[model samples]
Target: MELQQMRYVIAVAETNSFTRAAERCLVVQSALSHQIARLERELGARLFERTSRRVRLTPAGAAFLPAARQCLDAAERAAAEVAAAVGEVRGRLAVGLIPTVAAVDIPGALRDFRRRYPQVRVGLRVGASDDLVEQVKEGALDVAFLGLPTTARLTGVAARELARDRLVAVVAPDHPLAGGPSVSLGRLATEDFVDLPAGTAGRIQTDQAFAAAGLTREVAFEVTTADFMDRLVGQGLGIAMFPSASVHRLTGVAAVEVTDAPARVEYVIWSPVGRTPAAAAFLDLLDLPGPGGSAAHAARAALGTR
Candidate 1:
């Protein structure tokens, strides 16, 4: 019934350890347990199933988690709205970014945002695009910059395209394709490739493009970071593909345009529930028009700002 109880439950669910959750919430283990017990008793449902090794959410807990997050988001938005009325943006803003985000100057934007609202606390989380999108939907992140297909349809999230960058082939300067203006996927079918691991946004796009072109390459190395991939290609370990903007400044690698390759679109996505004043201000820094109009206006309407 109390807001603190809801927060405790959410913390426990996220950490899956009562001790760690209590530590994160800045409370004693016993007090956190007691609060959760009281909340379970009030609801007449077991929210979590505890065992010796791990704590797992029950079916009821899984179902209640979204509503609990929405309650917290609504409370934060209400508080932010009151502060925004006074032309003040002071709140925690959690933003997520993909590892290979290159189309936007995120660091520069953050620098500007800090100068504009020094009181706002900003937290950044870096991960793959899919992971970032899930975090935004779960309310763990207020906004996320993701690399996605141009036609990507994300449920429970509102996304707006920021910029699109063409995918290009990267190779060592001495490689056979390095001197070429552009290379076809079919030309590299038999070549060794350094690629992102499967399930990442970049890998998925690369795979789809190859599949569409009826070409397959041997993956000699799988790397998680773009810089690592570039280094591998520079060493002649294998050819690789990445966004043109990301590979333009590499020293030992040459980025050749990929003939007929699909472009990856960079999108800024957020939960549709609402945005805190700090989050809205950060979006304003991006100057992105929402799917309909101004993203800031949409956020204000969602937050019930007057």
Candidate 2:
């Protein structure tokens, strides 16, 4: 099947409406439909099941979607590689980060990257550190910012350490423990806590700290974003442990140093191989220190450019 047919199928699957897909593809409904039908006939499989109320991907379509996407991505990368050989970068840059990332100013960096390479399309996704790392490893994300426990190890990816910080106890201004000189993990464990979801890299650090301290704490609320954790702490619903760098930004919450608090390292992770030119450009903008030189050199090495 032609690449155009695959594009049309992807659009229809994503929008679930032929008319909307046509609009997205910038083509008429009939033309998009005709291409998909032609593709279906060639494959001898009905890609979509159409009904008056809705359109859904058939089993064949479900199976075909991922391969179609991979084909398009491979084709785009081929084009980008050709462009890069001539000292021009063109492609998509997909970046993922946890909400509590503090080492890099994402918006400022993106702004600069766009100014430097206007041909590259940029996309950002906010997710857990583990998920972001996995996405980078899978090549779904070109780069990711991760905050993991100081003891955590990264595998199957190339990474550069950005910053490190100890977590602080976050409590409402009126909280009984708010004015403390410093709190211990044991003391903090005595109170209810608001935390990132269990098992997440963000939460694992705190969980491990408490466990190592021979204490058990109750998590009164589990939320994804630090803002929600801060809000809950501001309401005196529960206390939270946040990276010290992030505490200053939280309103109505007082940060008390935790003597035995967990320390986290912020890292930027990318694929160990197959570095996209766009990804390389963005990493260069980060300008992280490396053994050889700037991260850009590493990116170039990954692209087989000595």
Candidate of highest lDDT? 2
Residue lDDT tens for model 2, 154-268: 9999898999999999999999888999988877878999999899999999999988989999998999998888899999999999899877788999999988788999999
Best by TM-score: 2
- The lDDT values for all models are 0.82, 0.87
TM-score of 1: 0.82
Scored by lDDT, model 1 comes in at 0.82
Error of 1 at 188 (Å): 1.8
TM-score of each: 0.82, 0.92
How far is 270's C-alpha from truth in model 2 (Å)?
1.4
